[model samples]
Target: MVCSEFAGCNEAMQGVIRYNPFSNVGFIEAMDQAMSLTPEDKERRMMLTYEHITKSSMTQWIDGFLTDLKHSFNPGQTSYYLGINFSKKAKHKKVNRLMQVRQGFKKLNIENCSTSLLRSNKCAIIIEIESLPNVKFSRHSVPTADVIETIHGLLIDKRNTIIIVGKQTRETLLNWFGRTHSFNGNELWFAAESGYLYKAGIKENWQKLTELENVSWIPQARKIMEAYVNNIDGAFIEERQSCISFNYKNADQEHGTMFIHDLYNLLDKSLKGTNTEIIYGNGFLEAKASTVRKEKLIELLLSKLTTSSKLDYLFYLGNDSSDEPVYELLKSERAKNMFFESHSNKFICSLEKKPSEADFYLEDVDSVRSILEKFYNNTKKKKKIRSFADLTKITNSIAIESQRLKKGTVNASSIANLNQ
Candidate 1:
């Protein structure tokens, strides 16, 4: 049985058996059904979802987003061709500017942008990695080995790469990045707490709170929050450096919504005139300083990178509401002026049909990997290899050549060798 909570319901609706664990009887029944299912029944159900999963090809996803973006700025030019005919003979010119953003740790697909830059001279990638969630309730921190490897490969390309993390302090992120393998001070940048803390060489920090939170507010607020949660079975509060998060995951769906509304109302009345800002997410309420935001960080990064020349192309991929501002900013006149006139792509990670500011939707983590891998494998070569066999042979040859060069074993006669 697949016990689905919030967002997993969409998966259950497709083919999987879904159960709400909050109800003992419902949970047991679903488990029984799963255990008793025949092989034929399971096969039939799995086959039903095959078409759903393969309908959106990764290439189609990228192409569709780029096509839509091309018409976005000048809709009046209805006859514009949306096809992107990547030229193999195209000269490897320095792209004046290339900027891309992705939510960190949610998925290991940041390599997609780096792979796109294999044909360019200089580019930038800004990623935001949220703080690791507390390891309570059987939740273990996942390994980021693949993520680290991808980042290292990008660093090898000698491009401007910045990783923004929600560390408690700037020094923490600095130390962490320092320990990462393949890290070079000249090639990579680190930003902590949404660009509020970052290396000075890249850009100056510009995040400023309108009015700082009162020092006494958290203590008083915690008392009221504790008193309120004491009566509720599943509600709990976690204190942070600059904010407090109220989680309602253990509550049933209906009661959880009611509890959230009541708590928001109660907190609003109790914390009136305080400087804390109450923010609502899927299953949690975060009361934080108003200055804690990602938009300013993104703006500062873009401003700093774009001064020398306008952007050649920009792409931003994110899966949260915080990402909306970044999307809106890229579509603004200021960004337009900084970009060589063309369309910019914004992709949202989504589960079901939903309204979003992004131009396209990527279904889930697997889709993220699929599209990213496609971009990573893409390269420009002068020779046209028609078959998979030919492509494989040439790719192997290039790999061997690269290995020889790295090992300082290249023969003099091979100096004049060409791909064709």
Candidate 2:
């Protein structure tokens, strides 16, 4: 029997066939599945509508035009970029309250709701929260301590650096080191979902947190500080995610795409011996009942964790594929509160939609980039024209195009008009 999720009545998505794969009910179904949103899915249909237009060839041309425009990278403070979707999701007065933490900004790997920004004197770290479940998952087979330490060292060069974790990993971090975490409303609905905030592990009283669900759950600063304490003590606090879920599937016209750059960088580090603490491997089916001994490998990895004195949001992103038995194991362990040996902190972020909770749904990989563009446009700030290099120093097509213009290679169009 076909089951409905969130709000079971999808009249707009009523079964209908079409000729072009993109125009068929299957395509719509795929979009609906991929979004993985909830009863309010219809309210946020624009997420996909906007995506369809963005996936259009014209959108790519625009993206290319902008990207061709240079780049630089300086390790900066981290911030967890999440999404609340719309302004009305919750009452406005609660925005600050919802962003509250029991303690001030500290570390990540120990929170109820993942923090968007964490600050501390020990080291300033940033984190960006993302969720891309479609990509193939692997155990980050390239686990190495020397590499991990070296990367950590580079971030600490300035004392305060940023790190990022996706929803899937957020829950994992919460489990590894008991703590509470959360992001703001706008932060919840960001498109690129790229930002990093350093999070420290810490302990908390779950019973107390539940009581303050409406009031200030905790102050942001205190949360980060608590996170730091947890990082140092290795005693994480516990909490669970709200009830509800969303789901979106891929259509034949398009295959899902994740930030190749993100995965590639991680893989590069692993292969280059820069990040040896993490490892990746063969498919999950390889283990029918037995895949690579995940527990033992994790055991070896956990041993490495002990040597790193302070807590940091060390995260791993995974998706469905035989290569990701570890991802499944992590998911399973999180539910059982068996993240790492001696790990008692427990929390849930609902990386996978449980039903009735997701509000912003989407399909089409282009939609991700597209939705982000709109969000960016909607909140257009009149800051000085930032060079592509200036926009996070990460390579962007817009920056490339801007460079071409600088060298008289392209037409003179305002950066403001790139989206138009």
Candidate 3:
């Protein structure tokens, strides 16, 4: 790693000789010195260079850079950047102090969900599939292979994993999971179309939870959304089994909002008396049956699980308006009866501080993935002494071996006999 002493070359020149590239004389002298190095010195320099490069890979650098960029958003302010404040009050001083204190404690014990919590408990993890880390909400986008494998591993480890998705159809979900044949029908579950449809496993058929046999308003809503998409340049429509979404992620923000407002009013008025509702968020508007409630799906899931064993922990993650019902349900007093008195529950949103019912927030998709991966890794089973008798026997053998060593009577034959 022969480089000049420049601004960004310091890290690269750490384990090797440096040369002044600007001066011919110095560069030639440095090359000659490098050529005269001993074999041992060359090996030492190679080892150091390898270690440094391995420790500072490009992936790690990019991760650190993105993390720094996210932190620069200024969490204390409601705005994305540091600018003027139109709000009546800024972040409270006491709140900032408490946040700092909490961060310090977090650093001391980074793993909030520990192994003991998972090992001795029956846990349920309900997550909105689109909120997964790095997963785009676009119709063409799908969960990465890594994400699929990680989720499969989590399911195989015996954690009750349930996925809630709004825009994706049952066929899309099946195809996505089909890419990885490792998915088992009994291990994973799906609550598709904002909990209007439920499927217990890959092999099971989707069951409609709502009383309405058919939603006649879907075609009318789709027609209205399609007209809007045709008029808007970058807007599009995604039709699911029980939901229809008007996506404007690629459209002009100001114009998209106006278009969505008009569409929402039209759909709201047209769908009235039909038990249909409309919801709009960041860049999309969706219409679905009002009877399709996530709270009811959760209740059904708990009812089934409680018949076998009480849940000891419940973790729910979401980042959309549709997920608020589940959050509100979990916070209610009636939901507490589904778990033990010492049970733990966490409601997390995959966004920064915002108007959400979630009790905790993660910065972005990457942060969400990192936390789930940690939970998966920590909950793995570990080997331990199964019984007190086995522990006592091992301790007695160690004591006898130490005595033999101290009495100068230890030998290969004695060791073999002890082993026997």
Candidate 4:
């Protein structure tokens, strides 16, 4: 369960089809069609109605009201595509700018102009005019694949664009590219090369999106684009695994800290602390958590084991400092173990089990739930037990390559060399 869509469902159950956020029609459509049917949908409507007024003369009305709703950053012409997410007060400044934009929209409308609601939030709205326009956007319409191919071809003989993304997505893409590159050795193209011989598709030429998400006509646009570009890889995770995890107590600040903190608490509580732990001290805010006693982490791991028999089928779950010590302990001769980035790619620690399975592996915090779910369904009550081999997509050429696995925890140096 790499995503939340199938969180509570049994492992034997097939995963559900989850909707994409940008399913195309528009956020306005989401407000009107998709969301209206849900309970929370009606709540947003009740709370954000503008002065009991029905919209008509876009500008004379509240053109900017909906557009400026929480609007600090303007991204794609589609206002829905942009705007920083509000998790905590981390975006108070954006909120402030959004209010200012909304006020400006109101003033413009009072002067007798016409516009229509394009997008909206509580603090801001994006208004479009029926007869005039303010912003000029370069227009191109095609499938995402076409754009990827076009750009990949364009950059083929030239330079590669550097992109940044949220850490998870970055890891996911990096893993994919590294694994693929390692197999092919050099010649790789999204359009020219199939993903793999077994199940082939366009190469995920994600490298092309870097420029669009980085270059902007305005400096603020550049900053916003940079933010998205900088965080583009943040969304990747274990695709076929039993868990979803993230640990951001160290890297995020303001709202990001709050966001990770919320997720940590949620995972620890919902999954039950028997298989999980949340690492934070009151000193984190006071900036003293840096000095906390880390020696206790080993004891914490020991406490989780009921038999004290040295973690026979363990999965070391971690993402930050609290995780490092655990990883070290798992790698020691005191235990019998093999590690995996996920459950599939075993970085065979001791050459013990022919790289076919993970006696135990290390996945970042995002994967704990999956590890536990697979563990529970496999060991606790086993009816239809599935081996790790059953989950592989084997290619005739890559089959031998699959048998070869990375040893020990997948570190930055090994990850960097994954494509070789």
lDDT string for model 1 (241-316, tens) is 5677676646555776755655665566667777656755445565665566656666666676667764544445
The local distance difference test score of model 1 is: 0.50
TM-score of each: 0.49, 0.21, 0.60, 0.19
RMSD of 3: 25.8
Best of the candidates, TM-score: 3
Which lDDT tens digits does candidate 4 get at residues 1-420? 112222322111222222222233333454455433556744554443322233324464364446556464444322122333222233321211222211111111211110111110000000001011112221111113322232222122111111111112333333332233222122222210001111111234432111112112223222222332234233211111111223222233454443433334333334342332333321121111122222232333233232322322222222223333433554555433422112221111111111111123222221322322333233312212222333342333243444443333334453334334
**True-vs-predicted CA distance for residue 362, candidate 4, Å:** 8.6
Candidate 3 residue-wise lDDT, 1-420, digit = tens: 566543243334346787544356768988888899999988888897686666666886677556655665444543222222111132221111011111111111225544544554466777777667544544444677777667666665454455545456777777776433433333667776777777766666788887665677889998777767866778888877677888887788887875565577568768888877687554778898777777788788777666777767666776666666776777777877664345454443435445555666666667667766766665544212223545688778867886887798776566565566
* lDDT for 214 (candidate 1): 57
- Each prediction's whole-model lDDT (CA): 0.50, 0.28, 0.63, 0.25
* Model 3 stretches astray by more than 4 angstroms: 1-110, 114-120, 134-138, 178-186, 250-255, 348-350, 381-420
lDDT of 3: 0.63
Q: Flag clash pairs in model 3.
A: none
How well is each residue in 141-232 modelled by candidate 2, as lDDT tens digits? 22133322332333322322223332222434433222233221111111010111112222221111111122122132223223223322
Q: Of 2 and 4, which scores higher on lDDT?
A: 2
Worst 10 residues of 4 by lDDT: 120-129
Best by lDDT: 3
